[model samples]
Target: QQQVKQSPQSLIVQKGGIPIINCAYENTAFDYFPWYQQFPGKGPALLIAIRPDVSEKKEGRFTISFNKSAKQFSLHIMDSQPGDSATYFCAASIVGYQKVTFGIGTKLQVIP
Candidate 1:
């Protein structure tokens, strides 16, 4: 099986922050671009992701910690901005299965 090429998909933090989500995958079919956010009765939304050619995607304040060789990835948000408050469902999609397997979404409320 071929390894996923990117180490961390455009994830960087300018300063110290807390890590909230940790995802590890063994399946080669698992998506390299792993990011999905869903709401009640709503379709899954793709928030921040990078293309195959890019290794890092940085938006203001959003941070990510990823280890591609270990097949592990995590997300962190700095400042706890009001916009970050949401029940986030972090998930991975299997290419062949046509399914998204995720844990019970984590309801995060950061007030600062």
Candidate 2:
């Protein structure tokens, strides 16, 4: 089952704008939620993450808001720059599980 779902296949933003990406999961067993940022020709790298115990987390210009009961999460990039253009993905996994389920991904373009 494709438990993770992402929205807005693509997004466009001007420099210094904020871009938001959202995701949802179906499996209650999923306890870990992580968002990844991928630039062309590179592997996805962890950007930020949160556990169900935490409602939200922020690091640098990236922030993650999690809703435990709704089984949903979202990522927001503040002061987005042209260099921030990339593909973002949301993922869900069990604490000790080897497999991680990923969302479809959102391509963000920050225009100067």
Candidate 3:
């Protein structure tokens, strides 16, 4: 069953703009949240991740904000550029578990 949900099927932003993608999970057991970024004809790569213990995490231009009580999380892209344009997915899983539930996906376009 699908436990994670994401909003805004697609988004467009100008260069240097910030784009946000939101996600929510239904299972409280989910303790790990990760966001993946994929470019055309390539496998998805782990952009950033957060545990319930941390409210937020940042890596380079990517950041993840997590809400443990609400079972929600979001990804924020800072200084988004054309190269950053890609399909992003939010996923949740239990710690030490291989099964991951992923959101539908959000396509972002950074226009010059």
The best candidate by lDDT is: 2
Whole-model lDDT for model 3 versus the true structure? 0.92
lDDT of 1 at 54: 42
Question: What ordering of candidates by lDDT runs from best to worst?
Answer: 2, 3, 1
Candidate 3, residues 22-41: lDDT per residue as tens digits? 99999999888889999999
Q: Give stretches of model 3 more than 4 Å off.
A: none
* Residue 19, candidate 3: C-alpha displacement in angstroms: 0.2
Ranked by lDDT, the better of candidates 2 and 3 is: 2
lDDT of each: 0.52, 0.94, 0.92
TM-score of each: 0.59, 0.97, 0.96
- Candidate 3 has what TM-score? 0.96
| Worst 10-residue lDDT window, candidate 3 | 1-10
lDDT of 2 by residue, 8-81 (tens): 88999999999999999999999999999999999999999999999989999999999998889999999999
Q: Give the per-residue Cα lDDT of candidate 2 at 80.
A: 96
Q: Which is the winner by lDDT between candidate 1 and candidate 2?
A: 2
Clashing pairs in 1: 10-56, 10-57
